[model samples]
Target: MKPIMKISPCILLLLSSFASLTSALTLTVGDKTSVCAATSLIVDGVLDYYQGTTYGGTIGLFKDPYYWWEAGEAFGGMIDNWYFCENDTYEDLIYSALMNQRGSDKDYIPSNQSLTEGNDDQSFWGFAVLEAMERNFTNPPSDQPGWLALAQAVYNTIWARWDTANCGGGLRWQIFTWNKGYDYKNTISNASLFFIASRLARYTSNDTYAQTAEEVYDWLTETSGFVVSSNDTTNAYTVYDGAGISGNCSDLSTGEWTYNYGILMAGCAYMYNHTSDTKWETELEKYVNGISIFYNTSNNNIIYERQCQQSGSCTNDQRSFKSIFSRCLGQTAILAPQHQSDIMKVIEASAAGAAQSCSGGSDGHTCGLNWGYGGWDGWYGLGEQISALEIIQNTLVLQYDAPLTNETGGTSEGDTEAGLDTNDVTNVNEITVSQKDKVSAAIVTTVTLVTFLGLSVWMVL
Candidate 1:
């Protein structure tokens, strides 16, 4: 038998509030009843943050500190729960939230969010619909655009905004010029496009979508030098944060986030699943190898945000990242089965850790942020709850069929140009920031923010 590790006074306090049988989540993998109970409990915890509960703000959007984009992810999480656990408890709310935010053009870009929303923001809502389309979830009425069409519209808009001139090619983080990070190109934005395109490729069987996914992958790794500077035969490429175009994209912000790595691995899995080609398989191996950096090996292989969790500085937006990462990692396990054992091991461990963290708050079930700490870390939010829910329910992934394709029982319909007017929604091209204007700001801004470019700048997003 292994000896017990002695706990410190501080650590004991952190774990004390959760010392209860009533509220702490508990789970065992491959047990459908256990998984559903855990997901149902945690799913309700996630919805507890919805502003709809208070009737103060919009019905679909979550309460503040949580932004509009993460709400999209929240609904996406519900879709996953419904599919895997066969739980329809939150379906109507999820559908209402999705439709309300879909902009006038029927894209995910709600007009109310136009001022602050960026490419990544819009793509997340698209990711929700993409999830809906791929899983053959309940579709909207005929008068409303189908899930596939809504997702396609978002894909088309972000694809149109792919800037070839600066940083060689990649989508900007912010959609509008006036936004703080407009000059920055981040992995989440580009990786999101890769995700939508790859899934679309599988759903549509269109070579164009696959080609688009490949191009974005190339730019992320090669041209932008943001993911990898060269094809490292080691397959140990570190996915960095982002880079500014002012220095011709030479100044790299090396802060790493879990979702950045997770999204790419997921897209690669989708591509491999579609083609059964070894190249995409190779790509998956590279990224899956790279995924180790996010895990806390000493703590039962629990996953945490490497950059910010330790520092206790993860912003409201950053807090929600693990939810996305865990969701995608689940996708990777489903689409690329070769990696299933390894991925599920981490997910299982993290889910147990997450279950421990959820034993805090008055409800005694509100989740804390860090899962590797053995118990609550005192940090709590919608991000924590959502993160816990995704990892826990994804244990049910193998019990269901892999995400559906158009020819493989998917019933969603599509429209090629469904959201073509998204540019008008974002108002990006309405006024251009000239090169001289861009370079002038980048010179001073880069020098001023050199030390904390990726570190602190994430707060604005």
Candidate 2:
């Protein structure tokens, strides 16, 4: 049963009294990490970091979150949580435990249960992180030189799978068939790939990448539109090898579509950011508007559910996935501040509350892990939490200040005249400084071990 949104007369009177407290809730920048950027980076690192640590491979660029449950799906099933077939690992929990244990009294270690099962929420959470870092780092002023080289490597891996069948306006499968070369195309995973590719194109300023991105994006749009278009339903409903395949191509899980919409909005934002292409921006606008409409009508809370359990009682009741969409909204706010109002406070609150809850555990590390579980349904590292934190921080910025303006009074990319609204500039600036410091600390810790290893090797020689 759905929880009713009822307000009693007495409760209403009490709410009125506390209204001042709510309105006075200032979103000042603090020493705390910015929820948006922090979470994105963490997600990227934890998701992919384990690949190098355990698998000796670059994280596979295209893999859907949840397709294994389908009756005929081949790539979905596995015996262990290591998920050797997909390079999944327990490293994320280890990192999270370390983050919390650092400079703390109680020793908090995630049980071996951390390696229990492979889930998509954690995958997408990580995917969102990597996607944002690669795209943002590759673009203009904040040119992270290291990321360029990294992007090249990941981009090549994605390109290796490109073929005649899945090349133009077709699905790109998340998990691939090694023997067949390149046979399957998972629609949901392909959506994320398109978004990632588009961001890569913007960062590298490569037309071929951009062109391919547009093709994939267009294909996904044509097919995924909830209301089917008259032009082409074939792309929308492409089957697995045959017309009567047990599970059709359009058989997408709600969780999959949630990530799909998120990356779509983000990819579109990146496209506009890099190309200044009105067409891409216009296309993204349609999705943002459409999603907002559907959400409002449904009273849907994407983060409130514990997995996709359709049962009366759930073993784990947690909130997940909403942060990805919220982070996407933050990206969109940066790209097009005018549309910020279109996203409701509920989204921001969901992201913020989830972040706070996740991070409020016994210590920072556990807080992060809990946040990951709250938002993604599995073990989380500091990196994923940092990414979500950055988004939350950015959302708070939009809510408290004007439509759009960084502390530098500089406008976002193409829009120079529209400055961020800062009613209390000093307080806001202080908050940003504090958050930046927290984020910088997290980055240093992650890279510290690698730096030390390199030094040790030099000494040995």
Q: Best TM-score goes to which candidate?
A: 1
Worst 10 residues of 2 by lDDT: 71-80
Provide the RMSD of all predictions against the true structure, rounded to 1 decimal.
7.5, 18.3
Collision pairs in model 1 = none
> Candidates' TM-scores?
0.88, 0.47
Cα lDDT of model 2 by residue, 309-377, tens digit? 232122211122343555566666666655666553545544554454333211232222222233222
lDDT against the true structure, each candidate: 0.82, 0.37
Candidate 1 TM-score versus the reference = 0.88
Q: Which window of ten consecutive residues has the lowest lDDT sum in model 1?
A: 1-10
* Candidate 2 error regions (>4 Å): 1-145, 166-171, 174-184, 223-256, 293-320, 344-347, 355-391, 396-461
